[model samples]
Target: MEHSHGAHRADDIEDARIKDLTERFRQTLSTKRMNELVSRSVSRASSPAPRDFGTPQPPPSVSDAQLPTYSSLRNIPLVPQAPQDARSLRFKNMLHSLSNMPIRWENPGLLDEALRVVPLEQIYNEAEEESQILQAEAESLGAGKKAAWGYQDCVVRALLRWFKRSFFTWVNNPACSRCYSPTIGVGMAAPLPDEQARGANQVELYKCSVEQCGAYERYPRYNDAFVLLQTRRGRCGEWANCFSMLCRAVGSRVRWVWNAEDHVWTEVYSVHRKRWVHVDACEEAWDKPRLYTEGWGKKLSYCIAFSADGAMDVTRRYVRNVSKHAVERNRAPEAVLLHIMDEIRAMRRSNMSKQDKFRLEGEDMRENRELRSCVISSIAHEVSKLSVEDIMNGRSSRSRADPDTQKALEGRTSGNSEWIRARGEGGRGQPNPQDPRNRQR
Candidate 1:
């Protein structure tokens, strides 16, 4: 009975403290507003308050840029609610598995050795020329204005061109080492002595297609970037791994980005831009994050970029058209992802100075805002593109946009522009068939 009385006394004291705070808050309001608030408080004290559904729309006087500043505290979600259903557990498991890929590139010695094979002279020369062109354009625009791409960005861009065109080969199937004929898939084999030494945990065995010589060939899937230098060809995995290592060699901080849909890419930190710039060595692409979704019509659920320092769910940078390109994000709840990111960040930054941590936190906040802005920009672009009929009818009437959507948006209209006089599209002679000039001609 004594303990229960003490607990009641404690509750009374807490209520008194809360009332004091509320009284002080009420005193700060204007006289007219305070009167109104008092009347509403009295009314609410008598009756239960009604629930609110939609948040208030911004007033007409407020501009789009000012919306963030004007956002009310009430707009923030306070309760910790589940973002997605339990169906997303599978996606979460896959991301955990994929996280291992980027961890492999942390070896400093291996990255340095990967540098030896890169054609430095050619890459540097190309970067210099491109930098000059960008500088000239910037000069023409105005004084003190920066060029679009920095020297380091141009360096990576040049390296990308050389890496994709001159160095890396896309391996769809292993060709016969003995007869130079196409090979048929024979099945998986245990790694040979040399292969295991060179970091190939798994080896694929292939047999020559020609009946005259049934020679079995070993195609080792080398994970080491240094080993990749000798082999010089692979799918998206090898391309991102080797190229990211080369970027690190050139003194740029790099991240190996893994996509949920079995794709991989790279993101290089640009000191000049104060942000991460997307680079894909396989496609010879630089700073085109929307390439997969907009250009290739690929749907993506997660695009996690992992570095030696940390990891991030950088899905927003790539999947701009959420309605179209967004896959089911349910692999785990958003809170779980947040916890994982925080854990990784704490582990990575544990030894860092307070000042350095503050700076990185600021960068993270800025990047978060930038990602949110991208969603807004994409929505605005889509709204602008919507036809009058679509708005009126509340449905789309026009045909779907082309798979090669970046051509119109990025001014990179032709994929054939890659330095190869190949048998098919992006050819020099044929203008984009979509172009009116080509149709008229």
Candidate 2:
């Protein structure tokens, strides 16, 4: 029995040794195979193949021949068409004139002066606090999380809050200085020599509403952003102009957006977000492109954003649903409008360095993508809200409008009710022709 137990232990030891040897052999084989592969790869990379001149080569493969040509698949580049008709010429000329707005604010000395009014310390403090809070929120979310906005974005937000609440004032009608009575609009007035010198192109005339204490007041419409720093009050034009300049004063790239519906706003390019953010100094709104149409319940025809760098027709950003919110864009042909935009962009970037022009072109492409995405997103949202029954019945989604949009349709809040109604911004109602918003400014 002892001999048998000793034999069994010997056999177990032998078996363990054999298994260990098998594993070592397997590892050795793997290492040898890997070395061979590496050597082959190195040799192939270092040496060119020897061609057999005596032997005929096989015909080159035409695998891609069946595929569509690149040009066939891609859209043709749009060739800008020059304006041929009277209306189109007028439209082009007007756009050219309006394109000069941002260029006027490019004075370095004036921009420095513009900064003096801003409470820099307060703005910076607010921006820091907001950025820190955003960072903390992002950290709390988890690893690889990013803050909603960067420091610069926070700075702009802070500036916007300060501008609307503390700096700028909205004026519909100038009050009588004599008795401080409410005034009535009495049509346009000529800008005084000093007013013209200070860049007031047009002046509005107003009379005191009081019967006995009749007083006349002149409200000059100053186009100069520097002059606006002192006067500090006007309609949408003045608000957009001044606020845009202030944005530039803080080293932000800015655009003055002109809407054909007789309203204007500012667009600040957010480097953090890689897009232009819609800012309305009048409404103190940020990134709400749908404010005019969705909030004010007004139809928009055109929304052209002009910058010192270039210009873009950003109508699609505001009027998401062409059938609903877009009015007739009949001022110029689509091709003519494209030509006008190209002309403005060329003029703006004519003096820029090649690298700067390239950078701006890239930005334009990115913004175009963003604008396209907006339309697509709006469509998707609408489709998502559609019910099977509604689709079958071919019913509109009026009753099922987006809750957020419906809430925004609470009417224009900036101006008085009478003014709002007069401008056709009261709600989704017909515009009063007597107080046309598109009246010459």
Candidate 3:
């Protein structure tokens, strides 16, 4: 009975305290004061937000330190491939193998030996003259202006001329050792142990045309640029390999471009231009990206340029007119190619600084923009080039004939539409009635 009375007393005290607090709260919410508070709340809510004086804004985009890179601005997926299937794995392996070709040039002794065959004096003289002329021209323009082609560029140009006109020999067929007669093509032959040891992955078989002697000649397609320096003769592969090595020896950044169409060429980085400049040593052509498609009337699929520093797709560099000149890129999926590119890029740049990596990424973005512009500019040029008469006639103007044009036309005779026209291609690769075997520089 005593416990029950104490509990009731405690409950009564709690209720009395609650009632007192409620009455105090009610008094605080009285008529005029409540109205003033509500009006202030409404005004504050209805008014514009105050400026954030405490917070700092993000810095501007970088493009030469101006516009942000696409990758930086967005989180769009690159769609990289994981390569689970057997086919994708096989393709990845082959590309990895092909990627090793440029890495071979990194051997200092190999590059030194490759340069021994070059006429350094002649090349240097010509380069100096050209460089001086370019410098003078730039000076005439105004102060702070730059030359068209840098001194290093002129050196490569001079070396290219010397390489084509005087140094390297384009071998359509190896002269038979037995009778010294230019040999006729029999077919491809398996590489001999000696040839394989010397770095030939494939060999071409040729039989002497002479009736008296049936001597079979083996022309091993040596991939080694050092061996090429000694032989001084081969198809586009040899030309590009030897020339690119020499370019490296002469102290300019160079790339060996491999095409799926059995063509190969060189691209030297022109520091003056801040880009890779196209150079086809076989045709003695420079900066003519459309020469294969436009002049030779061919289409291209993959044009991969590999260097010691990196590898790039570069298909856009060569094939500007996709509708007319691009072959189906069916070797691998686009995502797989992107993945491969990323892998190679990361491998090459694994050791670089954050700032260096950022700079290169910026450079890559700029190059991509430039390449895209090429397609646009090419389309615009084609549209503007077409005359009313051409529209009526259904024909476009043809480029004038030149020495290179003749060679490019010769390359077209291969008639392998799935592939493309290139050096050591055309009827020259086969038994022709014209006997293009005799035509060598």
Better of 1 and 2 by lDDT: 2
Across 1-441, the per-residue lDDT of candidate 1 in tens digits comes to 999999999999999987865554443333334344444544536654333322234334444464333223322332222225555555545545555655566667776676778888988999999999999999999999899989998898888888888888876457899999988776878988988998787777889999999999887777778878888987667778888888888878888888756667899988879899888787777788877665554577878887766678799999887877788976666656765666566767789899988988887888888888888887776776689889899987465553434442332322224412121123212222221111100
Q: Once superposed on the true structure, which residue ranges of model 2 sit more than 4 Å away at CA?
A: 1-78, 401-410, 428-440
Listed per candidate, the RMSD to the true structure in angstroms reads 15.2, 16.9, 19.5
TM-score of each prediction: 0.70, 0.79, 0.71
Cα lDDT over the full model 2: 0.81
Give the TM-score (vs. native) of candidate 3. Answer: 0.71
> Backbone clashes in each candidate structure, one number apiece?
4, 0, 5
Better of 1 and 3 by lDDT: 3
State which candidate has the highest lDDT: 2
